[model samples]
Target: MGGGHTGASERASARATERARSTRLNAAEKEKDERQKNSPNATKAIAEGMNVISTTSLKRKRSVMKQFRGKESIFKRPEALPPRFKNKDVPDYHKHPHKWVRYTLGDVSPEDMSDQSNTAAALSFLRELKERKELIDTNNIELEVPPETL
Candidate 1:
């Protein structure tokens, strides 16, 4: 019991001494600040701590980006198909005033029938290939019997 009391008193004395030292440091700092303010080249100190991180970056994660690099679309920004009216070169052929086509616009025109050559556009290709029939003819009699067994 006697030893405990002495230990308590020692701790109290140590705390008091520490308080006095802290007070002296604070006073000295205040005086230094006043002197700096009085000087022509006074500059305010930037109090940046050790933990001045702008953003939290986990070291475990090599990349800050979300998984799949947002290719999966869940973590990605929203997108949409651009409007078709981007330039003047693209021509709109709808006869109706609306943006969609009419069910039967100019279906049977007598003028179109009269000018058949004007309505047609020719494509360049091999004449022999165009006249040739399909290679596979399931209706052929020769296919029913195999020439030689596998």
Candidate 2:
């Protein structure tokens, strides 16, 4: 009986030692910086994730009113181009362009913008500038689209 108790204690001690070693190893792994492990791939992943929601897919959004305002032009013409802005004029109620920079996802820094969750920093920065009354809205007028009065 004495020999059996010693053998059981030895087995328990061995298991305790193994458990301690495993716990220490896991701690060491966790101590390593998360940024280091994810590195460059992490940045790329974040950018790709952000692009999944931006302007590139804007055309896919559906508009409720598809009725033509007038008869279509008979002559075949080239597609209308996006608005041309040689110099973008913001409002006095808005932030100066210099104060607010555009941070494209995959090409921008989170430090410049407020949201750490997504690459919406550029938009956030613009809104903040406008809120601060640093921008002027002469060339930066907002157009009101009248709702369809059914």
lDDT of the candidates, in the order given? 0.53, 0.56
Model 2 accuracy (lDDT, Cα) = 0.56
Which run of 10 residues does model 1 get worst, by summed lDDT?
A: 53-62
- lDDT per residue, candidate 2, 53-131, as tens digits? 4332233222211322353432477889988784686664475667676665876565655555445756788789887
Model 1 stretches with alpha carbons more than 4 Å out: 43-150
User: How far is each candidate from the true structure, as Cα RMSD in Å?
Assistant: 24.9, 37.1
Give per-residue lDDT, candidate 1, residue 59: 31
lDDT, residue 17, model 2: 82
- Cα lDDT for residue 5, candidate 2: 98
Give the CA lDDT, 0 to 100, for residue 127 in model 2: 86
Off by over 4 Å in 2: 33-150
Cα misplacement distance, residue 49 of candidate 1 (Å): 20
